[model samples]
Target: MTDQTPLRSGGRAARRAARAKALPDHMRPIRPGMEGGTYKPLTEAGVEAIHRAALTALEEIGLADAPETGVAYLTEAGAVQGDDGRIRFPSALVEDALARANRAVTLFARDPAHDLELSGTRVHYGTAGAAVHLVDVEDNSYRECGVQDLHDAARITDTLDNIHFLQRPMVCRDIPDNREMDLNSIYACCAGTMKHVGVSFTDPDFVANGLELLHMIAGGEDKWRERPFVSNSNCFVVPPMKFATESCRVMEECIKGGMPVLLLSAGMAGATAPSTVAGAIVQAVAECLAGLVYVDAVKPGHPTIFGTWPFGLDLRSGAMTGGSGEQALLTAGCAQMHHFYGLPGGAAGGIADAKMPDMQAGWEQMCSNVMAGLAGLNMVYEAAGMHASLLGFCHESLILGDDLIGQALRCVRGIEVNDETLALDQMREVCLGGPGHYLGTEQTLSRMETDHVYPRLGNRSSPKEWDELGKPELVRNATAKKEEILAQRSRARFDAETDRAIRARFNIHLPA
Candidate 1:
């Protein structure tokens, strides 16, 4: 036993070295655009019932308060307008729009390597919200989120392998002017990440300037149109069958500018929409289908996402409960509808109602996220850094959520069983002739990186090894990691010439 000690130590060192070497993006254990949809929360009959209900809602209880432009667009597409100023869609019109919808949509990234193909059960997770406050975990306090916080969050997201895209997560509270806020929001997001981005305009007038900024970034209008990396998260409706006039106008401009639009219909369960889960989903589906018709009316086969985001409400306190099991069910059910319609769809997930990234946050974030992935939601927005039921964002939680999503994505990847994975030969060799255990086998060494996903900050150390090193708190380690990433120069920043050109053209609020 004493003579084998040196050999064992050498073998352990070799294994450690092999594990430390990084695998290419395609060879990684889990990655973006992985297929999910294995979990079915809604039966086929349930999906059909919801679809019939949504169509009935559209035909009977039509939406009201469309902007003049939207009214014209919808009317031209075979919708009938009654004296009550409500637009009602005929069943044939809705079917035509659905038929003409762009089914095979690819959300291009500034770097082609990160482009997301949104078809089938492909799943991608990323940050998204309009959180007003930033949660400071150390002091257990919240502060107003600003442009710098948004930029930092994007930079951090750029480094995380599991975060597939970056949407403007927080509002720039410092910029009081709505137009300037909208412009700066686009500028900051583009400067901080090469991944696909999503943003919303406060006013329709701001979209031209926003497109101009994107044009400069893409070198020209044609190039920006060819590969529009950013999408408009347009909440075109005010829930309960009403259109937000200004946001509808913004959606029109964005579509004409050749930008993809996420037709977001976010209805609160007990407040704005119906109280029942199925009823809330029906309202959300009706609203987004209306928006889809509106999009196809403006331009046939335009790139659009069927975004039906219905958030949960805690009845006892009358507050939003983004982290509840009901929220999980709502998102999962929505994914089923998306699948039923065969549209590229998105829904909210991984939001923590907890004030901090504690035990409650972990359970809340994981519960909905895993469900969303399994249900095969195309875009899982707000999958990280959101807290206080979408009222606050935290950098530490975002860092930790990377590991959390890595595991969630692994679940989404599911188990692949093949002859090789069955390991019949390896088991026979080990049990019959070779060593009794398979730990030191060549198969184990070769499959270590391919078959398993190891978390960057998660500790797998035993009690003895944990004691040897000072016991580290997860949040503390996250904070340290966040600082380390931010301290380094941003790999996603624009070139000096482009940065100068943008600053010269727009009122760039973030520090140079």
Candidate 2:
């Protein structure tokens, strides 16, 4: 394929080229209920139902009646104070929010040169890994993962067409300094990658340094400014009570700048609230509404993304087992809560408690991701190759997760009905025959693009062929894919002068 290559052929081909240029391609869904399967989008009635429930929770059931500085602010903002750590919000207050919030927003990824369009039923996935695990050739001993690991993983993830975005700072544990110098972790994690992340909710100094890192990587402040650094308004509950000051300040920053923030607050039923999904969903809503008051206080109608970083404690071991059906249910219900507010929501899905890749890992990862997509979440982070939630990263887990993401995306293709697939005449042309002569037909070949998810992880080989090649399992194959990506990853393209500037900011001298 030389630069001056001649490729087009046939009169029909010429006609196609002309038609394509004159009129861009139109879209048709993949035919709803094609095989007794259907997806339902939220209707006006459904939204109203969720709102009514939320109103009842706030007006009646109430929130944890506790005293916190953040809750004190909410109490000032028309939230009814109650006893035993319970507070209720007026339903009118919530209805007013639905009329004012932005439901869609674009997240700046990489240098804003890489951002994702998040709206509608679209969902994105990625990971934030600390303590490198699976890519290792040794024991639990993590590799010296620093800037190199960040760039390495970023490059691999960027090349994966299946991965929607790379969550910033994937390798924080191996970066030497975790406490004071930690935001350096965010700087390095986001340096050359094309992904979205707020500076990992760092302190002011680290945040400043991380911003400096972004300007250097992106060429200038203007370039960095071109892509808004995403931030979070993480609301913390003082046991069913209110948010923290740190959370409040973050929300102020996000709302003031019109930066997207994920306001997540979790209450455990029985442990934190009642042992009911509806009960918990309402509590989560009230928690986020507290965040909304902060956002509205800073700048009315700020771009806010709803989130749920909830987990239930296993009272026996007192472990936060987030990888459970309870969490999945929370995610689905959380999606509804945000939608009710007419805001983009973020949820943690495709998460697992598995220490390594196994059946448990696959099941947990796939179910969570699919559930989030079905709920039409905007950002679904905590992605693949991550083991035991945040224990470390794994090449195998990443690979399998990538495939799982592809599967979830395929599910969202909805339905397509056109001349190519409707095949009314084609069906009539072949149905009566012993064999449907559709194989290798022109329509069959042309439409396979919209038809399948080409798997790079799971086994698709016959027993004989697999046995001849040493019978590798799915995990083994996934590990090999990660290695392949690593070997083939080349340094990102940057002009020498710009490159020098980037290196110089980091105090590294480059050749003239």
Candidate 3:
């Protein structure tokens, strides 16, 4: 027995070393575009009812304040402008627009390997927000977020396995000019990661300049059109049923430029929208349906995401509650609506109302993230690092969110009950004549990497082992990981000649 002990220990060490090595993309337990429709918050009848309500609202209530170009587009596409200047869509017009909308959309990345395929129940999680402040966990304070912070956040996101894409997560307060800020936002996000980027234009005028930058990055206008990597997250609608004029113009420009558009409708319950969850969903769906018609009018079958992001509001204080259970249900139900329409969709999730990455942040982030993934949201935006109900972004929280999302994705993967996964033979071997345990079995060793997702920073050690290892706190470990990732040279940055040309052409704010 003593002689065999050394061999057993060596074998265990070998297994540990094998597990430490990274698995190829195909062998990884969780990945982008995993199908997840396990937990449906809305019944089929409920989805149908919401769809009918949205159609009714568009037909009767209508939406007002469309830009001149948008009015022409919608009117040409069979919508009528009422005496009140509101565009009223007949049910047939809405049906025709839905029929012409692109059902399968692919959000391209600078690197083709990272492109996201959006269809069916496939899910993808990523970062997004217009956070004005950055949460400093060590200082326990908040400060205005700048372009440098945005770049660093993108760099960190590039290294995370679970964060499938990086949307512009913060505003560049350092750049005083909105035009410069818009351009800088594009550069910072594009430079920081190879994943598909999502950005918004503050003005329609800036979009031409933004496209020129993208053209240079993509080699030329023809190439950019062939594989447009960045999408315009256009908030075309202001609220209950009014078009944001400037944003609608921006959407038109984006669509004309061959760039994809996220037709975003962000209404707050009890504020911009109705207080009830179903009512809020109805309004958001109606607004996005209108935006969809506008997009199809500009160009038939244009790549567009049905972005129905209706946020939750704490009625008592009139504050946004992005982390509440109600918010989770709202996002899930919206995802169902997207599936019903057979359109690719996106919505908010994984937000933390807590100011810091603490126990409260953990629960809040996990609850929404898990629900969002289970609902099979095509694109889960603001899925990490958002805090204070989208007011702040935190680096440590973002790092920890990678682990949280990995686990959530595992839940989305759910269980496989086929012959191999059931493992009746293995169970029989263990319970009958074998070692009476499954540990150290051949099946266990073979399935370790394929069947389980091991968190990079999540601690699962025994108490004694943890104490011996210095009892590392979660945020401290996350901070260390953040430092390590940023300390490395950015692989996602453009080459020297391209970078130089970009800098020369634009007022690039990021440091060399």
Candidate 4:
């Protein structure tokens, strides 16, 4: 446990070795662009191509106004009506919108007031997926999501400080307990124990509950006013780019209310989008911009976070997969778009296509997260535990996300070109022919505390020592971490009377 070294000396076999010191798993498994996996992403040049294509989509691809007044503003901006009466964006108009946007802006959540600071640390972690989790992929088949799972997940996130927010897991049955009630239960549990929340988006009733929770923590409406409660306002766009009504409604609610909302529009290329990947990004961008326009239209400069998760159609299964290269490309490109506008960009992470935890899960989570990091995105929405596009939450997956976020955060800390880091004096000293052993230097000792990454499960010992210590997979390692967190004392607490009152209101009972 010395400050100079993160790993133990005698390996796991050492009598004093307590494996409690390793970094979380998500930070460990990362390789760029699937160079080491089956998945492949669009090249940097490809991203440039898509950027050009996005501009063209405004001009050539053009947006067709689907009769939504809120969406029609883009048409007024620069899009023309085609023979089909669709409002098509001209290249100049698309460029204008990009130019007009603010590159980086903080999103304020009004009710459960919070500020999403999205600079320096480019990515923020949060829950992923929506709808019901019919299949319990981890335990096999579908099972009802009970109170235990929700509470446990919230606890796990609360204990793990790296998780940015605790989002409700989509359960099979929200019970009579309507969807709103089910959501409230999850939110209540999360707000009760956790300090930060990504906040469940959609459903007006749930939104109200979220606002109440935010107000309670923030103390009053004035505090919420200064800092807004943030949530996502998603749009389901029809192909070639068209906005849905629900998206517009949510955007206005969060905006006028002064809460930060991420405008997300996911369209499949060759399906909900145009045939090409570039075409899809253009359409998706238009869809997101249309939502932003709503925010600006109602109250100009309303705190908004821009984002998209569009991907190329697999053409095999009609599912929206988050692990696609096009998805990565779109995530990165959208960051550019948001930056172009000087607005914070919302990206995604911890996405896995595997029905259960496996190599597929690990790989998808790694690449998707990296794309957001490399692009210098402001925040990532689907930042964790995304299996089947967020259908299920694997406990291990969430654990992995904490580490994944840590890695993404580390990446955005561009190389510091300071005197110490540049090592100029050391290089000069070495050139003088005197033995310059940096290993024992005070500078090295001080830097090692923050510079090097220590793993939670990565065995640093020689193979023989590792074999002697009994090789363990990452899951077993994570299981231990979970147990450790649960066992440790957490200072998080609420008043007993208030806890009891909250339980009575929600019809939930917590053991004393």
Candidate 5:
């Protein structure tokens, strides 16, 4: 007598909506820190040979132009200094530093949700580089990059699901003062997104200014040190066995300030480094090992990434060919070396020689992105948005790259195998007792959203449906997505008081 009619609204549609809402975090098919290393480009013997060669270079050629501070640090770590002013690392010293280095590092984000655990062969892709120009896809032109552009890049990266982190993708050309540029770059990026950021300073003196801003954002110096969200991408070496004096000093400050360091050694093949790929790798490894000794000398057990980034050269023109097949092999081989030493490492990938996001750019971006993930690169830098060998950054292309990296990470996740996944029971039921085709079975309906990744902007409709939808191009859709994301104000920004204090203390250019 008390029973009433049950409320129902659009029965089938409501049921489908319920199924979509049931997919939770653990059910996601692809996620951060998926194990890789399935593609082994280097054999065991080859890795050993390369290691020995690197040690030989360090012990023989040595590194010249080591600053006084660096000299003291390295000398304390068992390195030798000759009367000729070259600091040479003995094989024992190099191995000792390697043994003491952090095998894994957690690159944290302001929001705990984005922390990346870089250990073993776990893979993560993100944005990186210091491109001088911004690509105007509408006009097919380029202009000098400014601080606002950098903030916008971070803002877009914050919203993208597959872009794991945000490094400084472009330079603040409008800010002429180096100190102001460094501090403002940190402010603008941190304000734009809470994802872990990677920043570089032109001078060691400027690093203090940048760190001051970071300290404010993290609430205090101790809090910043406890969970350092930013890493210094220090290019410590000038390639071919020489130290960049200023950058080395900067690296020292970064190590002591409790920030993680990417001991970057970028040797352009056929130009600064050897013409052969193996020869380039050997030089990069030796240089980074020297950096390793220096870091341990400053502070033992500091978090550092073994960054052996060797860019390929176009022999015909002697210009960089960062999108070449050879570049993929070089990065993959470097990952193998990092594995050999059991150290956390990073390498460059997903760069394009094409100036815009075209068909050529698509092929070039995917090749290295897939290989870097499969080769088990702990951190894949420059994995999106870079073009023209890193001379230009395209916002539209960065949006498109979100889809590419999602697919690449799925590849890294590989295929899961179990009784449930094999689905022998479901297969038999469909073939023997049920419908000839398995379109909407119970198992299929349950697993559709969890087992597969669908692109946000990539079109997969049939020809008729595509025409009906006006044949939207990928870049156009990417442009619309970029506009849509930028239109929304970011919730992950500093409070008004902090922003005002930063702007008042420093020459911050971002509008309040």
Candidate 6:
């Protein structure tokens, strides 16, 4: 055979031409709110065992340090307050709260098109953390994240298609005042993206201030109440069956203010919680169940997320190992429990124990992301941009993670088994009477975008092509994309009139 006997220029041209056409939104297969739950890491017996253990824990050991309001509400709703001040729940009360919990809740966005209907195992990925430092990929160092970094993170999140929501990912280290820090974080995230935003408050009273700011952004108190787009990611419990008094108070105010609440229970195994994975899940579930009862007692049907985040522990040194296989299984198991209770829920995943966005980070992020998505987590938090096991946040990694999540969502989407997909006719045509190859076929060209995912920074070039291009690095490409998105000069999301009013009232740190 000659060196170049065949000429497939026409086929190559046709493939390129087909890819150039934009696929419609409906046909785009990989998007937000895709159905998951195809993977079940926990067995039926195992789930039941964990559920029973959680109930027993609530009924027996109970949770200590309940705020007065929470104690009163929960006690009135059938919880027993012991002389030691530990509030214990009977299994009936837990079951009743689960019955009254909002199974299908809609997390709204300022732009209605981005609304998230969290029900069942419908999966969505987003950024979430309180990383104080920003991973300076260029300098190979870390620096304290300021208000502008938080805003820029949101803006980048707004532009990413795979990242469905913009959870407040970084703490505004520059804002010194606690109240101002809380308020400014909300303003920065809201001004950055129209996607549904999730934030936390150090003080309960700060929630009211944050609410006032949200009202101004929503045009009025009534409008903000009508469609509360923000959620309070409240860590209600301090692991091992103890309530965080201040955070519980904050959750109560958030619920009273007509805001969604995420009852986050983060337990680190082998330290604050039991070393066994199932035991860790039991503690998380019991704590969140107590939280659910607290919310239901305060206001029945209030939207709450069963945030059972159980982090893995490296027993060797007693540190969090968020990127380990155990972490993936822990998160997936938590998702199964959410499905077991039929409540809207979220779990932690897509985090990297690696300090940088290298090959290790990529594998670690994808392992948990794929597991979380496959297990049908409604909200996959910390799914992007987190590094050093949540100590650092990288803007470049965040941009690159968008591409990673797209592929994970594709796996959660699974496969279709229709007659057309069976492809008997195409097989016959190719083998019996047509060309030996299937490339450039009608089905191949049509399903290019729908059935396949294309990454923005992942290289698919041949070795020779890569050498010809001077070997572009993924981080460098991601940095360029981040710069390109931030360089855009449009801040119309926050109109000048409203922005001036906000700045005049509060110390809005984002510059014009």
| Whole-model lDDT per candidate | 0.94, 0.59, 0.93, 0.57, 0.90, 0.92
For 266-379, candidate 6 gives per-residue lDDT tens digits of 999999889989999999999999999999999999888999999999999988999999999999999999999999999999999999999999999999999999999999
Q: Which stretches of candidate 4 lie over 4 Å from their true place?
A: 1-103, 107-115, 119-121, 134-147, 167-172, 176-179, 182-189, 192-196, 200-206, 236-240, 317-320, 417-419, 422-424, 427-437, 487-493, 497-512
Residues 455-476, model 2: lDDT tens digits: 7667788999989978887766
- lDDT score, residue 435, model 4? 67
Worst 10 residues of 2 by lDDT: 28-37
lDDT of 1 by residue, 140-208 (tens): 999998999999998899999999999888999999999999999998888888999999999999999
Task: Kindly report which residue pairs in candidate 6 clash with one another.
Answer: none
* 336: Cα error in model 4, Å: 2.2
Q: For each candidate in turn, give its C-alpha RMSD to the true structure in angstroms.
A: 1.5, 6.6, 1.2, 6.7, 3.1, 2.6
Displacement of the residue 108 alpha carbon in candidate 3, Å? 0.7
- What is the per-residue lDDT of model 3 for residues 214-249, given as tens digits with 9 covering 90 to 100? 999999999999999999999999997999999999
Residue 244, candidate 6: C-alpha displacement in angstroms: 0.4
What's the lDDT for residue 109 in model 5?
95
**Residue range 263-302, candidate 4, lDDT tens digits:** 6776667676775655666666666665555455456555
What local lDDT does model 5 show for residue 133? 100
What candidate 1 gets wrong by more than 4 Å, as runs, is 1-15
Q: For each predicted model, how many residue pairs clash, with residues at least 3 apart or on different chains?
A: 0, 17, 0, 24, 0, 0
- Against the true structure, candidate 3 reaches a TM-score of 0.98
